[model samples]
Target chain A: MKFKTFAMFVGPSVFLMLLFIAFPLVSVLLNSFQVTQPVFTTQEVETCSAGFLTQNCVTEVKTIPVLDENGDTVTTTEWVGFSSYANVLGGQRFVDAITSFDLGALLRIDFWRALRFTLTFTLITLPLVLGLGLAIAVVVNNATKAIKGPVIFVSLLPFIITPVIGGLSIRWLFYGDGIVTVWLEALFNTDLSIAANGWAIEFLMMFYRVWHVAPFAFVIFYAGLQTVNQDTLESAVIDGASRWERLRYVVIPHLMPLIVFITLIHLMDAYRAFEEVIAFSSESYRITLQYLTYDYLTPDDAGNRAISSASASAMLTMVGVVILLAAPLRRTWQEHRGR
Target chain B: MSDASLPRAMRQPLSLKLASNAFLLVWLLLAAFPLVWILAMSFKSPVDAFSSSAWEVLTGPRTLSDGNGVSIVDIVLGIALAWLAIKAATKLLMPMTVAEGTLHRIFNWAVVALGFGTLFVIGFFFFLPLVAAPLEGLLGPLGQPILGITTEHYQAVWVENAFYENFRNSLIVTVGVVTVSLTVGTLAGYGLARSGSTLAFWILIIALVFRALPHSVLVAGYLPVFINSAEILSPILGENAPTLYGQPLAVIAVLVSINQPFTIWMLRSFFQNIPVDLDESARVDGCTHFQAFRWVIMPVMWPGVITTGLFSFLLAYNDFLVTSLLLDASNQTMVPAIAGYFNRETTTTDQVEAVAAAVSITAPLFLLVMIFQRQIVSGLTAGAVKG
Candidate 1:
């Protein structure tokens, strides 16, 4: 009887999840494997190869074509399987576009540069956001009644403004002719074109992202901090522990679960960082995987499908790495909690 | 206890106090600087705003000549009024005369009025710009000279720019997406919550992993498949596929996919919060599983439904990337519409107009937040705390 009831309750969600979320993913997985077209013929290969490869050494390539509105002709084509993958890997496009376009060696250089940029952004912003959030939470937790309301309200204002508006505001603030840039230049006695350098762009993006996201972290941490056992802290104080010692020994350990939770969640959010980067920086600073995928998927691009799939696959691998690294920590936390 | 009689509670040294205060001051400045700068910039003209000397105004003494200076005026007036009221209350005792009583009553009413009035005025102006411009344009020659309070902006918004059409498209997309996602997600959440099976648990985890994939990446992948499917489905569906690409349906499909996991997560949490005893009682009373859920669980989860619905609604509304990618130029949402007006190589006037449009776009959202502030705050913080 209980089984029947539970089954009834679980049935609808299972069906919908399978239909909507799971189906598309399964389809993508299936499509990734299939050879969509016949391989390139020897005649065609010879015509294209010129002096690059030996004559009659035919490379089998599957072509995936994007059809136009009329569905008659192929608007664009991607040579799939090893050929496409080889193109991505071999710096062919980089060599071709280097003189005319500044698209650099995407596979070898751009990919790693973007990865490093994203990693640096995440590393700097994650700890800063966490630390700032925890500190704010501690202060708010300790604040007197008179000052609490205004402080909390002000602190929470960033949370209330949607990322779009907040990002735009940041963009306006740091744009070349804007106040922040001018002020920084004057103060530092040097030109600081925030948009010009990749590091500066990354830094600015991180600051905006942290500013927008920190309030959320602050509120969550504050809630978690409130649940911390006051007696534990008081006992630490009685035992002659300094404030830092008490925080380190009792509060930090207590906050570990929350820290992990927030970090994991924020890391996922950071990986998908798009709106702020798009709003704040030009396309040159497309230093994240998400931006790279977006660039590939832009309207006129021929490599939309393959590049998107490849980039998504890359992102999934990154997520897998994160999950692997965090799993042990998560298990330890869980065991500690259980104990 | 009196201030002198009360014991000092672990008094810190002056240096420590100073250091702490300095730290707090720096943080406060960091938090307040952007907002204060924007508030200041809003009053200044384009030239004055872009001037290098404007940064000095931040540190220097308050001056009206800095800008139109309404913000300063309001702040000063508020402080002075507060100070005066405090002085009057502390200095005086009984209401001896009609004048004193009237003054006190007026002051009391002023305070109350100011508190609510400020909120009201802010809301009014926010909405005013959005509506007034287009209305003034529609008013035509009679709307000549573009009065400071004119509805020219509203007219421009509506008739001149097809703002209403875009708004309609947005409305269709937002409503469709929210309704579809809510229906689908709520059912899914119920299933996940009720199912004791490990399969359900793993499926839930998979759903979350899918959700965690950056939206841009998903949308990037989604565009090709959707476009291809639309092509294939066109012969059968007929008129649907062509419309699907840049239409509200595209927005709805993308948003529903993006939002389903969050809805499931939130709804599952809400459903789990409800006691199992309610289900048992319902069952004992001869209600079937569906009936029990309908009568008992659904009502209890209404707040969750509303919260999730609002979130999905906001997500759909605030979204730009998917909307920009999927929708045609004519079918743009207000955010993208404003963004379009200020892309690379935009003119100064274009930037201002874009800002005006942006201000228009966000105004309604701000109003919605204010009206539903309680629900929003609770919904936002619900994930953090148990109760």
Candidate 2:
């Protein structure tokens, strides 16, 4: 209980967190303003040739920089202030598209496209995760033990698999000539590929999100179910409340705080949509900011990486995520202070 | 739909009950069918597994079974089997006194009859095709037919894909993560529980915030250090020092850091439930605080620690992005390996091996879940229920 004892107890965890998490956060911020590239040089040399060509002369060994002194093509990292951010913003092209009011052109910017998907993914999945999870929890709570164990196990399957694998499983079901897709086409007497259109792909992504995460909500709500005041439930039963009314009045209110906790976790997670996009192979019709950062880091044909751009986008993404999480975060902080 | 005849206290409508059951059954299928199908596909021949229709997987070269009709005798026997199985299972599973009156017996009989009919249809249609095909394949020369199953896919995936190596890497990283997170997190959680200082409370709140920070965001932070390890780590250990990138140890460290916050939150509450008197008594008897924790506290807290450890294992095991990005290609984890299965060998890929690889990846986790379902669920819901 003493300060020294507490420090001795807690120091290792804090040290790990700071070294791995806090330090990297600061490093990312610093790296966003700096750039790195492969070093290149231009030079000439002199050589002697055979008698057929009399003599072949080359320039002396005078190394030349790949770019002018002030340009960005240098091999070394440079502190370029917000230039990386501006470049990521697509400065001239984005500004022109915006001024001209071309919606298609506006979305053509990789950052904007990724941001759009990320925002939609986060906002839309929030309510569904809460609602569906609550529904499953309520239903499962009333189930017999024999049924309950298997049902819980089944529900946790999606949540237990790795995110990328979960997405891939869902994608495989509707992939090219996949069983469900072909069966649907045969039954309905029409051909429609879920992966062929943007909206359809988005739909699958959204559906996958709900399936993958609702179990998390269900588990939390199921725990919350155990904490509901039994005396209050008994009193409500004596008052002849219907099941639905009991749920609305007694259960929902009891689980409100847990709901908020789940919402906070979901928002932060959903905003960083990387795995699903990759698993779904949605790069053609869709992308998320997280994937966009990875895209920047991917080596180009010439083997150069866009690390500064990736860092800038990562910063922008953090800004958006923070903004999205701010309200729930503040509420939690206030509750802690009150406690 | 009218329900007044059911009794005044139990006025629930038949329609509502039917609809609820139907909806829940549909949801159960949605949750379970994918895993079952994947399991089936994993055992199928490559020809059937990759066929445009999943039906072909079971319909291999064999003729179909005769049309089976349900008769009075078959129904009666089915109901008998269902009743016996349920009765025996209940006797083994619980100590409750089962109803045995004439009326209760009649009701149980009716329920078992319904269950029997359902099980019979499912077994005849789904399980029959699944099992017979495999049986026929292995014993076709003895007047049997095609089983449509093969071990070749699993063999190819295991031997050719370097799956064993990646699987080993995953095991090492996940185990390391669980050990590290539990050690530090339990101590920190106990410190918070015992200290009850405002500082400790605020630290928990901060940990929750970090828990909300997206992992991909954290991966972004780690990239520069990992990629520039020699430059960054040289001064700390002085030249030719070990670096973080391409090391399973680095992945394990990051995973532990990511998972520690949740571990502390879960264990702190569990530790709080232990009476402070126990620790005080140990201290009064001339034991140090550390000794009190190790001796007095730990024995009572094994369940909570195991629960936290299971969750930490899940976090490390289920992760892909952090492992894939930080570890070298040769040292990748299973989940990422499965995700990249096609791309890594697009030219040489037999396609059937994908499902085989997927099955292998899920096999360990499947066993883990089967063994610790209760602990995993409890760990997940810890601390969230209370206000």
Candidate 3:
């Protein structure tokens, strides 16, 4: 292709990406370092009110946002450097908690609390998803041909359903005298409240994530299983390798790149764990970093949003993604160079 | 060895086979039960929907007392009609339209779906009651309630709550995002696939990074711009330029950009698989680059395009965050609207209605999976296997 044609073909996509993805990144960085506030002015006026038998007048002062000619609030933006970041990171309260060696206090700060859950959720689910996915793939691989299609179809329901809806379905199953809870209560002869406990909510959230994501992993791994080297497997069998040995050595090694691929995709996705927070309504007990940023952006009753802090939190999330991506990215770069 | 032939070492032992099948059954249940359970709950009354007893949820005895039971005739006719529709769609409608290619097939599908929906409405509401009322009086026991099922929650949702409006908005957003993303993505992907330039590779790597960034990060960046877009555009379009905030178009643009990276990566891999020699020969035969691409390349790119389009459709349709934040109440999409039912105070009736809404949204997805399961499976493996 000529450079002109290539440019023509790639131009619109590049433009949109740069405008939406690239520009927003730079803007987020800049905004994180600045604060915007509506300018306020204090005013006093005499007020008259009709009493039961007499009129009473009083002068009172109130602060109000100054409106411009267009009836929009007049706002000013000022550079605040890292103050917003500090605020989002808990500022002096974080320092106090750290200096006091208070683990509970450290976890009490919203940012740290969110970070802990986000990291734990991502890390814990990785192994479970991988293991369950691999197990399903292997079992399905061994199944009769007639059953494979239906099995795959059934497995895909969880992955293909909307994330929020999937979460909601699982929540309905386990929350407040839900069928599963009821069954468990009957079996154990004890009462159980899933929603009332933080640990249970966290467990359910992770369980939902694993349920939702493992099918995706299964699909990918199943695809990977098809291309596994039969000659290598036969050679291992000839060498008297047991079934587990054959899998541990021949099969898993073949699927390692795919495992990495799934891991990278899973990490990227699980880091932005926002829907589970809403679907499970775990705001009181648990929140993820993405939800923390969203919480900041959502306006309160006073119609005030923490835009700067939201930006800071968003930037921090992007940084976390980049860090998680570093190893896989470097491996890709090396492979590209080697090729 | 042939694929059907299993070597002794490769085959599962008897005990292993039983255990594996058992495990697979357990997993299959785990995977499919929630959707089945939810769909069942949607048709029952609130009491039955939330009942601690699984048997009550399944039977919906309270729903029967509430004058919402389905007669044997209704059940038999409903199932027969549904079976006939599926058979017609597969055996007749599919063959008739599939030969005309993608666009025609899609149009045909829409027509068929619309026809089916109309038939269903007429059968359930207008025709079934009219027939069943007299039949129930005549047959007595035979025409009595065999199951407790109701469409009342669906009525409350799609009619009373006007959930159809959100469904319409969702359709618009998904359609716009898919069309725009695929158009731009296919061109760029083809360009990148054909180009051996280092810049293309680097661009792809950057796109990978962009794809990894959490959606909230992008939304944070877009929020300020969208909120002030009227001001930004006023200089170019006069003082009355409209704000991009709360507009479906704004959501479409954001979703397209968010989806573009994955789109490009997937499409580029697909494009790379098509032998370049076909286009090369077209160029040799006095075709311009654009003509070669259009006449020679795109003709064969349909499968890849359709696969990529399915994924793009899924992303845009399944999205909750961008749509919720960018759109206002009147313009809200189905996912966010369903979430709204729980966000506020709600009665048991409202919760069941919300369940109906959730089930309603999943119906199209179910249809999509049934029809496009092969395409979806291939699409999932396309990126991972190639990359």
Candidate 4:
């Protein structure tokens, strides 16, 4: 295609992306370094009240947001560099917790607590999703032809389900007096509060993620399995390789690229985990980095939002994702260059 | 391939087959049971829906006494109608519309959907009762409640709570996103695929990075701008410009941009598969570049376009963060509206209604998967396996 034609064809899409995606990214980076607040001014007010038999008058100074001519609150923006980031990092409390070597106290800080859970959640579920997906793919590959379609269809339900709905569905199964909870209580002959316990909730969140994501991995791996080299497998078998050995040597090597592909996508997605926090209602005990930004941005009862802090947290999250993608991204770049 | 055709060494042993099947059964249960359980929960009264005993939830004896029960006749007829409707929609309505060509397809789909919906409403609400009332009188004992089910929760959600407004909002956002993304994406994707410049490669890489950013980051960036949008637009629109903060339009713009990268990548891969000879040959016949693209390339691109469009639809539809944060109460989508039902304390009945609302949203998705299972599967694997 001619460069002019190419430009013409891609112009609208490029414009939309620049105006929305690229612009917001730059805005977020800048906003993290600045603070915006309603300009407040102190004013003196006098009040008169009838108290029983006497009228009392008092004067007090109050701080209020100044309103402009159009009745909108006047606001001021200033360069604050890393102050917002410091605030999000828990300024003095972070230093104290680190100096005292108190891991528990460190986690009490929202940023550290969220970072701990998000990292663990992403790393833990990566292996489970991979393992379960591979197992299902292997088993289903060997199943009779009659059952393959139904198995694939049934397996896809969790993947296709809306994330919030899927999370809520699992939550309902283990929530208070829920079916699984009731069954477990009867089996163990003890009271079991599944949702109240932090570890159990964490386990459920991981379990739900693996269950939700494994199907995606399975489908991709299953497709990879179809093109596996039968000649290599047969040659390995002729050389007296066991079933597990043949798989280890032959099948896995063929699927390595796909494993890396899935890993990259999974890491990108799981690092931004937000739905599980809401679906499980874990805000009180557990929160992810994405949710932390949302919390900062959410308006309080007084309608005050920490926009600067939210920007800082968002920047921190984007940094985390880019770090996770670094290796695979370099590999992709190299491969493209080679091509 | 069948087991008999495989060599003895390649075949699975009998014990392994049994264990594998058993494992698959367990997994299938894990994957599918929640949807089935939730579907069951949506129909029962609050007492039965949340009961400790599974059998109680299934039978709903409390619901029967509340005069909201289903006789054997109702159950049989209801299942029959549901099965028939699904069959007709998938096997008949879908292909018929596809045959109607591009411009008319949307109109045909709307007609089929609205027609089926009206039929179901008439059948379930009026026709079923009219037929069952006389039959119940004829067989006194047999007509009594065999299984308890109720539509009250569904009524509360769709009618009393006005969840249809949210559904409409969701429809507007998804439709707007899919249409705009696919339109722009196809052009950009074809352009990139045919052009082998370094700039094209660099653009794809940048898009990949953009695709990976957390949605909340973008929202935070959009938040301050949206709040001040009215003032920003006042000079342009002569002082009556509306704030974009609480509108569905804002969600659409953000979602489209978020979805564009994936859409272009998928479509570009699809376009790469089409032999360039088709369009080149058209150009050789004196057709302009745009003419060749529109007349020659687009006809073969429908499958890819539909597949990309399905994914774009899913992203817009499944989104919660952008929609919930950007849109206000009156313009909330179904997912956030359902979340609102449980965000605060509510009665048991209200909780059940929320369950009903959750189930309601899944129905359209179920139909979508049923009709386009092939497209969805291919679309997913296209990125992973082919690209």
List clashing residue pairs in candidate 2: B133-B147, B137-B147
Candidate 3, residues B39-86, lDDT tens digits: the string is 999999999999999999998999999988888877777788778877
Fill in the DockQ of model 2.
0.45
Native contacts retained per candidate? 0.29, 0.53, 0.72, 0.67
Report how closely model 4 matches the true complex, as a DockQ value: 0.74
- Candidate 1 has a TM-score of 0.74
In candidate 3 the C-alpha lDDT for residue B74 amounts to 74
**Candidate 4: where are CA atoms >4 Å away?**
A50-55, B1-3, B7-10, B83-110
Give i-RMS (Å) per prediction.
3.8, 2.5, 1.0, 1.2
Tell me the spans in candidate 2 whose CA falls farther than 4 Å from its real position.
A45-75, A230-241, A301-303, A336-339, B1-11, B62-143, B344-349
| Model 2 chain B lowest lDDT segment of ten | B61-70
Task: Tell me the tens digit of each residue's lDDT in model 2 across B209-308.
Answer: 6776667667877776777787677888788877777889888889999887888889998888789999999999999999999889887887888888
Task: Please report how far candidate 4 places residue A231 from its true position, in Å.
Answer: 2.3
Provide the TM-score of the second chain in candidate 3: 0.95
Docking class of 1: acceptable
Q: Indicate the residue-level lDDT of A46 in model 1.
A: 24
Please provide, for model 4 over B1-387, each residue's C-alpha lDDT reduced to its tens digit, 9 standing for 90 to 100: 246878644598778889988999999999998889889899999999999999988899889888888888777777888898789878977776774466578688778789988998898789888988888878787677789889899998999899999999999999999989999999999999888988888888888988888889999999888988988898999678889999888888889999888988999999998999999999999998899998999888989999999999989999989998889899999998889987763788877887888899888888787777789888888888875
Worst 10 residues of 4 chain A by lDDT: A320-329
